[model samples]
Target: MSDLTPDRTADPTGSAGVESKGGDRAQYGMCAGLAGLGVLLLVDAARLAPVQSSNDALGPKPVPIVLGVLLLVVALFYAIDIWRGGVGAAEEGEDVDLSAGSDFKTVGLLVVVFGVGAALIAPLGWVIAGSLLFWGCAFALGNRHHIRGLAIGVAISLITFYAFAIGLGVNLPAGILDGIL
Candidate 1:
């Protein structure tokens, strides 16, 4: 029982009858950053051309405007929650051990993979480029089934391309598969 006791009495960070937890200043920084992003989104939405009164109220502009407003509201609420002395919940349930230090190698690999995909997009087009991005990200994140990942990624990208291009009336560059796609 003596071994389980905490020597809080002698700790300078705490005082008698008072409990102290180290401040999560990072929360405040994150809140501010989110608030800034909300503002930027709102500004960008404002720059979008207004729909003619004849057109339906629901358009590209309204969705982004609503999202920006919601982001601002959420950021405000989070800041208030933090100001009221809330502590963040400990992260849990990830496959990786949280006790292990940061994995910079995996992070760098993911960044490089994403960069390569983005660079390839212009020449390779949506289906192939997006497939590479998806498969590369999965591989970087520890999925080792390269063939399975590539197949799944290519299928997803093709579905997404057709869905957006045919259903939504959006034009995606088809690149080498141009006429065939």
Candidate 2:
């Protein structure tokens, strides 16, 4: 308030008359620029003819536009955060989690289930794919009670099938069992 001023001479960057937050600003600026680029790419993709096809009412433009706007919003948030000196302090401790274990059985089972689902989907349609994904994920998550896991998996799969196929009116592959043959 009096004659006291900020000790710019003691700044870490050693720039007595320069802004000391340049590193933080540069880091966030780079991230924001990259995010903006990603958003622009999606916007450009939405402008492509393939995305504007008459195959569907909304076509592919809707999703890309939504995603592009979302990315741009996030980029703006990052830029504002950097401007507010909200760059988090660097951590000095080890944060690694080395206790994780490999589950080869679950991994192998998931691959087999996906393969079977893919082989059957065109005939079985969304019902099979939804069931396979739910079951594979449940088993992978270590659901040891097979009956309970199966019940939950089937319920989720049927619900998803109804949502995607009936509610959303999205056509799923109905493989060898096309037309309920």
Tell me how many clashing residue pairs each candidate has. Answer: 0, 6
lDDT to native, each model: 0.81, 0.66
In the range 13-120, model 2's lDDT, one tens digit per residue, is 333443434435565766677687767878686676864557676666676677777777788777766665554443344877646677688789878877877776
Model 1 spans with C-alpha error above 4 angstroms: 1-49, 53-57, 71-101
Evaluated with lDDT, which candidate comes out highest?
A: 1
Per-residue lDDT tens digits of candidate 1, residues 68-96?
Answer: 89889999988776665565443334797
lDDT for 151 in candidate 2 is: 76
Name the weakest run of 10 consecutive residues (lDDT summed) in model 2: 14-23
